[model samples]
Target: MKKIYFFLTLVFTGIQVQAQKDFQGMAVYESKTQAPKFEGMRANRDITPEMQKNMEERMKQMLEKTFILNFDKSSSIYKEEEKLDAPGQQGGMRIMMNSFMGGGGTFYKDVKAKTYTVDKEFMGKEFLVVDSLPKLNWKLEQETKQIGGYTCYKATAVKEASKTDFRNLRPKNNDDKKPEDKKEDPKKTSGETKTNFQDNFELPKEIVITAWYSPEIPINQGPENYWGLPGLILEVNDGRTTILCSKIVLNAKDKATIKAPTKGKVISQKDYDETVIKKMEEFREMNRGRDGGPVMIRR
Candidate 1:
């Protein structure tokens, strides 16, 4: 009985020690100085009905835009975490997304975020929490560098073009041109027609996201919209560079329990992508008939 009790005590002690070594420090992504360019995406259509519904319902829910992530770095398993929110425009509509990675590989959640404004001391700014999927398979690249006294690697990834079945954007009588069809379609006689709008951009193209992971941290996590690295990503860049862990304080005096937040609708990343496309198409079709905007239109 004495020997058995000693073994059980030793096992419990080992578990406690392992639990203490997970991810515990805050990984900071500081935005470096870059010249701002005034490029705009002109969309003739407005927000879709579905998107409008979501905006109306959940726009007021507070989100954590910028956060200080805390975790336990003692063990391979990360069971808890916390996100500390700051005050700013991009800070309020922020969300905590959870993804799982292991021998089974990484799986992401399909989450939708509404556009919102969080008042800041400087000025009122806007940010968007778009619903998207993990279309790219992320892996470590050969180029490596040291960050926060730990070795990190760069990874390249991309999201492929997805085809969606949405509300019909094509004209109803596209295939049929009989005499009866012509008579039935009065709008055809009027010159108003649905025009095919082409949005030209490359798809399934490579998107470069430079991430520096530290083996010292030992937890697979990152910032903004990325993860799946072997260690905590200290820095990540995709043209617009987001450098994380520019400053890290190890063995700080605070105990931050990092746990995934439970909120927002969780769906497969693919489903979320499809929903976004469907909404976009619906919005475009609804606006196609407008002339010089709705306010100016007589009818």
Candidate 2:
């Protein structure tokens, strides 16, 4: 009986030691809102008719875009470890994004740059950029918080918003409101709803974003346009909707290869957004429907 109890204690200690080892992972980000003030827009139940009309007109000309970021777990190295692939790590990470008006999606490839050897100049660099304009930042803050079963940390970062062009959108006119046409089609008789999207004018104030990272699996990566947290960003709230990392996996048996996408030309993050908007406007114009150009979808 004494021998059995000792064996059990030894096994538990071994498990704890293994859990302390650094790990690699991939997390998916799901952003619910396009802009910071979207919630306020939703709450405005007392909007006036003219104000509503203008909002609707603007929505017709706006472009919608989404971005996803993938990270390379195999590119990471631990302080006390050598430079070699861990048990089940792989190549790199990829992010996928889509634009509504612009007819496209973007994939970020090879986010983990080539790992450096031990005792080299760039030894402790955490974040790496494999494609697109390079971005490098580190994971900091040592405190831990519970995220699922793994312990995560509170991490903060300031990243510039991707630059997208809001200029020269497809011009659209309010739909003709003839009484005869309205009476003829009961289903389409209702007036269009409007929304005042604040995408134009001055750039938004520098965003202060916060996220939770997990140290249980030591890879400093996350999904959809964010990385560099000490642990993976389990939840990110940037004064908008909260993007929680619903699930995370580390060192699974089958390793997934992370690679850069060669589909679109590599441009600066800002330029990329702008180009997508411009392309969307062009697409709208080219395929304007039978009702004379792009009909104002809202007001």
Candidate 3:
């Protein structure tokens, strides 16, 4: 009787574990970013209140976006829910920004493998960026909150900020200075430097990202490049941007295809970053002029 009971317990435990591994779900996220607010504009010195309001409204419409995450126990696929482009955004610049900043591609994460793959489309070219996933040292906190009826615990991480992140983009303080007023650098070997890439591409060295995850889901996954949590991350605040979970469905019959992209020019993440930087510098040189006008649009 004792041996029979032991065998039955083992069978029941295996079934329970198998049930946990079979859990699959789909999560929808709402991501948004704030418009650039200059100090001069607030004082109405650089622009009128009416103009500022219109600018903000237009940018808000462009920045508000949505994403979807399909996940099982060990791997997940994240991608933006396709939407029509905003007016005046049907250009190379917008597409490049999206491709570079984790927007234009289908992102696939293999938690067990500790790797990620992104199928990015930039400026009419395709790239399959594959690299090890970012290892975030999540500092779990005692604080908890409710999101979409699930209790979520708080966690924070300090990670290196991307240089190409659109939030870092802003007009330089001396952008309106006259060409005559600017001094030339004698040490620059590339003859007369048309534009200074270093001065214009400033960004925070690091950013503190706060996340809220729910243990009820028991899945270590999140939207975009965010993961490595004890549970499913429902919300994330990265200073200038926020991605929040709006809805979730568990074990849906129509499971999303959670596979890594198989086509494109294969490149590591580091090489891709360097490629983007090089192209941006080249563009600046091409558009630079003697009139001291903007080589790149502020918006």
Full candidate order by lDDT, most accurate first:
3, 2, 1
| Candidate lDDT (C-alpha), each | 0.42, 0.42, 0.78
Expressed as tens digits, the lDDT of each residue in 13-86 for candidate 1 is 99888756532565544543221221111223665666644543332232112234444442111121244543
Candidate 2 yields a Cα-based lDDT of 0.42
**By TM-score: ranked, best first:** 3, 2, 1
Task: Give the range of the ten consecutive residues with the poorest summed lDDT in model 1.
Answer: 97-106
- lDDT, residue 93, model 1: 42
Top model number, TM-score: 3
lDDT of 3 by residue, 191-261 (tens): 32234433444566788999999999988999888899889999999867899999999998776778999
- After aligning candidate 3 to the native by TM-score, how far in Å is the CA of 46 from where it should be? 17
What is the Cα-based TM-score of model 3?
A: 0.79
Indicate whether candidate 1 or candidate 3 has the larger TM-score: 3
Looking at model 1, residue 159 earns an lDDT score of: 44
RMSD of 1: 13.4
Question: What's the TM-score of each model vs. the native?
Answer: 0.46, 0.46, 0.79
